[model samples]
Target: MKRYGHGLVLGKFYPPHAGHHHLVRTAADRCERLTVLVCAASVESLSLEDRVAWMREVHPGVRVVGTVDDIPVDVNDPAVWDAHMAVFRAAVPGRVDAVFTSEAYGEELGRRFGAESVCVDPGRSVFPVSGTAVRKDPVGCWDFLEPPVRAALARRVVVLGAESTGTTTMAWALAEHYRRRGGVWARTRYVPEYGREFSEHKLTALRTLHPGASWEEVTFASKEFPLIARRQAQLEEEAARAGSPVVFCDTDAFATTIWHERYMGGLYPAAHEPRRQHLWLLTDHTGVGFEDDGLRDGEHLRPWMTGRFREELARTGRRTVELTGPHERRLATAVAAVDALIGEGWDLADPLPETP
Candidate 1:
């Protein structure tokens, strides 16, 4: 380790994983004080504040600054080089003696800043990690992240929509498709459908009770999304316990809110707001057709609800990979995609890997 003034790290820290922590800890130990810049949450990665909090926890006495409102700098894009450079300068007040990094970009950043550099090289030998790899196969990549993160991601994906639109059909098709193929990571757990569980529960519970019958009940029903969000967290914990990777829920907490609002004309935007980041798996409704299952509110209303779903998704600005084709086709497409990801070296042994 070469001596330097202060050690600084430049990264979005989207969700500080172990790899990041290792780098930071190393830098903090070498330099007198460590300064970390938290990237803006609205950037492409769109981080939640958890990463920043984790960094704080690690270096309780370290210097911290945040660029919550600044535009995120993607160093990859030469266009933002000057802009992000300017932001970087602004993030840390005047001259620092040194910058620390584990990635090549750190060297480049150090050169740009005219600062001495200390590098912490953590390649394959250090840890086979990255949040991107972990997210792609949370269950398989569980060991890469912290236990808390793993527990938060083992959720169940439930796909739902108006009757005949292929919710149950897609669910069962996907479940069977994945199961027959041995599923990802050689894990032997069945993908459960929310509707099946809901229906079964209804068969036994409806005989004794109804789905909360007041307008308030309907409004409350509209609020089931929060329950879904809560369940997302709960299920993540369950998957961790079961040693499964993160759940690939077909539908999600927001979907629950969307359905309730449609059925009861009641609003509960809060439920979906927090889960917006989690609803990354949606299909474009541009060319999809609806089947008649009698559970659909109406055909005329199909476009309306679907439109609303898209609109809300747009509001969140998350990308969507429209699952096209018939229900069977969509299932085949989803399974193939997951398989491709696995083959590409997405981790399958862990769920939410500790900060990596």
Candidate 2:
């Protein structure tokens, strides 16, 4: 290993797997000062900012920088090497004393800068993974990815419906089902319904003060819905970051909008917009008895609320799959839908946009 004043590591780090980490960490150890350049192009799916953020988060010791480059990727033409060298020099801060890479071009790149080229693990013997493999099969390669990238690629299955529709129950069931599946390295995570948490807190407060209050009297302020929506998003993001390839959300922001309409008589702007999710598993109320807890309005409002949820879902135009039956049956239906989505090549790295 050759020591250097300033070392540089450059790559797309498209989904920055363990191999990239090995390369950078190895470089950082040998050099006094190391800089990692994450080069992204227009054709790449992951944004340049996101790639930079991941590198910064993972390797706080090394300087991480990102640039949008349209230069030829992996081109060996000598004529273009000068052009590429200019770009690489411009991308890095000052003079580079050493260039570290596992590619054939490492020697040439180093020579251009009058620096030593150190090639580590050219055979991929240390970290047996590639960005292409990670992109093609994220779940299969889940162990290779860093937490931030894994979280970003986690497939979200949002279970949604009106009150007493068993959204929470089903959400847990789906998560458990995936977790128990044998030989799968990637685990599942569940995001509980945040609105219900807020409502329970408010209900406890009301019962303490009022002593005898009807469900109708436990009304929510228009202002409170936005808070619930914000918390819901935060919880979902937190769960993803914690490293789960498949995340089951009890409900999402779109459902929060419906709840605002139910009590507040209007939409809460903060909760009005829908975020990207793979599938909306709408739970049906048929044959599912509506039992009122202290927070629920009653069985009478279930039908109307369910219809309103349907309307909002349709208006948003996301991929929808309705689950109706007993608990076991509902669970089976949901599992099959998610499996189908995966079988059809659902790329977690690049989420599909909401249907226009």
Candidate 3:
């Protein structure tokens, strides 16, 4: 158990998983200070900044840095090795005491660095996973991924429409449907509309002042929509991190924008764009009747709201599935759409090849 003054742990870390963390931790434990160099190629799907950020968040105590290394890897080629070493050395100029790695190239890497090459779990016995396997099939390696990585990879599907159009019901049903698949799908999560919760709280506060304050009496300020949108985004992010490969939302920030327009009679300036939403399930109000659950008051405006949603969704170019018909039929259609989404695996580009 010889401790070193400075240690180095470098890798692509396309999406930092348990194995990468284990390697970093092991190196950190055996060294006074560790520098984790994350080398990403230009052709790769994941950005160097994101990979660096993920590593930094996961290994805060360790110094994490990133560099763009577009040079192809040919371990046996001295010229190619020299090119890579240049990139690695420039990124970690002060490193020297030890080089820690789990790959078979540890010996050569250590020799080039003029430091001891300590291999941690070279056989993949501990935390058996790799970036290659993860890129090919992220769902299969879901458990190995960290929260940040999972959040980034999760396919967020938003179920939204006019009030009482079964958006909440559909979201819940979809989550349960995925949970039935077992394994990682058992942890599938459904995010509730934060706007509804906000509305409920607002009504409660109003009633405290006026003993008989009704739902209609509870009004929304233009400023409140931004807050609601931010909270909705936060809740969706949290659910995506903890849940399965896909997360269902009963109404996301995008829907909040529409609600803001419906109530405030103008577009919200700070409406959050649904950047992470992979698909939208727009529940049509044709077959579903509006139920006044004390929080809803737009029964007559259902048609207008539904039409607006359709127009906005189309305008935004969002991938959407309009759910119509009976509850059972809608659920079945929703399930098929979700299954197809999941089937379209994460299209993470392959990294630079390393010669055997």
Cα miss at 72, model 3 (Å)? 0.3
Off by over 4 Å in 2: 208-216, 271-274, 347-356
Model 2 lDDT per residue over 40-148, tens place: 7777788889999999999999999987777664456676677667777788859889999998778988898888899989999988988777878877788888878
- Superior candidate under TM-score, 1 versus 2: 2
Give model 2's TM-score versus the native structure.
0.91
C-alpha lDDT values of all predictions = 0.57, 0.82, 0.92
Rank list by TM-score: 3, 2, 1
Q: Per lDDT, what order, best first?
A: 3, 2, 1
RMSD for each of the candidates: 9.9, 4.5, 1.1
Best candidate according to lDDT: 3
lDDT of 1 by residue, 1-356 (tens): 46556878867655456777777777777777789887654533424465566567666778867775355445576656676677788878778878887776776688777887677764734767775665555555555656445434443344545434555556556555555555443342333435334534444454456654322222224444555556654543454445344245556555666666666687775634354223233554445665543223355666677667777767867544446666567777666655554355422232222222
lDDT of 2: 0.82
Candidate that scores best on TM-score: 3
Please provide, for model 3 over 133-188, each residue's C-alpha lDDT reduced to its tens digit, 9 standing for 90 to 100.
99999999999999899999999999999999999999999999999999999999
User: What's the true lDDT of residue 74 in model 2?
Assistant: 44
